[model samples]
Target: MKQKAWAIHFIYAGIFLLLAGGQMYAVESFQLTPSATKFLAHNVGPGPDTPRGALNHLMVNSGADVRETIRPPGWIAWAALSAGAVMAAHGGLLIARKK
Candidate 1:
């Protein structure tokens, strides 16, 4: 009974990690709309050449529909996917061994 519980826990953890990795992998690029830009500027505070200033500058100079493109690095997604796969496989092996 204790071993089964442990296996179940591992499986659940693996599933969560896998889902997170998949979501991370799916987003190659995204755009932040004008409103989102403004929100960020407000929260990020002001500076001459910082992110907040950049966002503010965009809001002031660009059209209302203009947006900022954000691209996260590829390695982060790959790392998550690799880690999640390893976790999930380890969990599956734990479950199988119990049975």
Candidate 2:
């Protein structure tokens, strides 16, 4: 009886994790739009002014490219999602056995 209960809980948690993990991965890509101008300015560095100039310099002129800052990476989210799926499977088996 207890194991069956656990299995149901695992399935629920797994579904939640899958949704949350996908959202997290998506948000990272969205950041580029909001930060575009600022990214160019900083990346181009001190010297020639203006956002347009900076953009042209960064993309068109392209003398020295700047490296983007790194994030903690999405592997953790992937891991969470994978674990959740396993838990759900195990839980499902338990639930099935109860019948």
Candidate with maximal TM-score: 1
lDDT of 2 by residue, 1-99 (tens): 777777888899988887767776665643343255345555655544777565555653464434344354678678867877787788788788889
* Worst 10 contiguous positions by lDDT, candidate 1: 39-48
Q: Which lDDT tens digits does candidate 1 get at residues 1-99? A: 787777677777777777876776898787887778666655654863888587676664565665657787878777777777777777778878877
Look at candidate 1 and give me any clashing residue pairs.
Answer: none
lDDT of 2 at 26: 63
C-alpha TM-scores of all predictions: 0.53, 0.50
The TM-score measured for candidate 1 stands at 0.53
Pairs in clash, predicted candidate 2: 7-91
Off by over 4 Å in 1: 1-27, 44-63
